[model samples]
Target chain A: MNISGKNSISGMLKTILQICFWGGIAFLILLPILLFAIGKHLNSFVYVLYPNGICFLIFVKQFIELFNLLKENNPFCNSTVKRLSIAGKAAGIISIILGAETIFNIIVIKDEITSIFILGFMCILFLGVSIALYILSELFKQAKEYKEENDLTV
Target chain B: MGIIVNLDVMLAKRKMSSQELAEKVGITPTNLSILKTNKAKAIRFSTLEKICEILECKPGDILDYIE
Candidate 1:
């Protein structure tokens, strides 16, 4: 449980940022496939693509914040970085839920059982990831407190 | 909540600057500042040991029980 202060926060931030970056790329790359499997074109929907794009952008911003902090080794930036990470995770979860809903609606209206099952599975996976992220946040907060006390004692 | 870092006193007794101590302890100056300012989340035993060695002091010299 005892980790170097520099390593612990940086390690967590790095992992979270990497997930966000890759997750964004995965969603963007799969957009066309998802739309095609749903048997719809983006041009047919007005606001469907934009929400996912916005969430990706937020995640990228957080990634940048984390990168800057890592480079500067700034302690003051840790809280802000953690906050932005939570915000990015929240946005990602919301966008995933919305995307699932849209896909589900399309599948039901089109009587497509396969797409419905796939989207439902994806929704479940997203829920799992969101829950894990929330738990990690709480754990990090506890670790932070524990580290504070240890630092004082030393 | 009960333990406080008496780093300021140790630094004064040793005539050491935070930056110097940070270098000796192998931590960033900002981390040292956090420790000195009572904002750090935790410290490693190795770092604490380094600080004590550099300051020519014991753990008790740098920490105190607060009422």
Candidate 2:
């Protein structure tokens, strides 16, 4: 089978995503310990980090699956659609959590406009990604049906 | 699924094995099995023509409409 450049790129991206996945896990586990060791306390740090870390991990997993599909040259299969849908749902949940965090920040730290803006921006970014992924998943489903029909057309 | 593929019946009537028909029709045996088992979603005109030519039969001989 002739491997396309797309597969090569996806393979590289899969490696990067795997690195990010493990790095994120390590960061999440060590952040609080590091903060305590440094004698610094930030009440919202752990709370924000945990949810965002989980969401990022889920996104990395979805991308890993997607890259594997590309490597297999079966990007339009049902599993790809499922992974995209899961990614979309995870992003949606992350957006909601970010929105809630923004509200909490606004109420608790009234003068921290920079942090609030950043949180709000991330919320919108994740929401947009969620919508795009959901649409892509639908398109993938249609493409998968077409591929199945074509495969059986012989 | 109202359209049924009767390829196996036609092959049996012509005293032909599926593997032999598949070789003559230039399709994989797995694909011929798909058509024979009525699992195929669609058939190409070229493939149908080849199958008909090899089986010495009409397209309708290998396909049937069942309501």
Predicted model with the maximum lDDT:
2
- Cα displacement (Å) at residue A77, model 2: 1.4
TM-scores for candidates 1 onward, in order: 0.46, 0.90
> What TM-score does chain B of candidate 1 reach?
0.90
Model 2 regions more than 4 Å off: A1-12
Give me the candidate number with maximum TM-score.
Answer: 2
lDDT of 2 at B55: 86
Q: Give, for candidate 2 chain B, the lowest lDDT window spanning 10 residues.
A: B1-10
In candidate 1, position A93 carries an lDDT of 68
Q: Tell me the deviation in Å of residue A7 in model 2.
A: 10
Q: Residue-wise lDDT of candidate 2 within B1-67, one digit each (tens)?
A: 4999988788789999999999998889999999888889989999999998888889888889998
Clashing pairs in 1: A147-B41, A147-B42, A148-B41, A148-B42
How would you encode candidate 1's per-residue C-alpha lDDT over A1-154 as one tens digit per residue? Answer: 4222544565666677777777777777788889899898776332554565665556566656656654665533347438555754865565476566657467556646775666567566656656666676566667666655765543
Number of the top DockQ candidate: 2
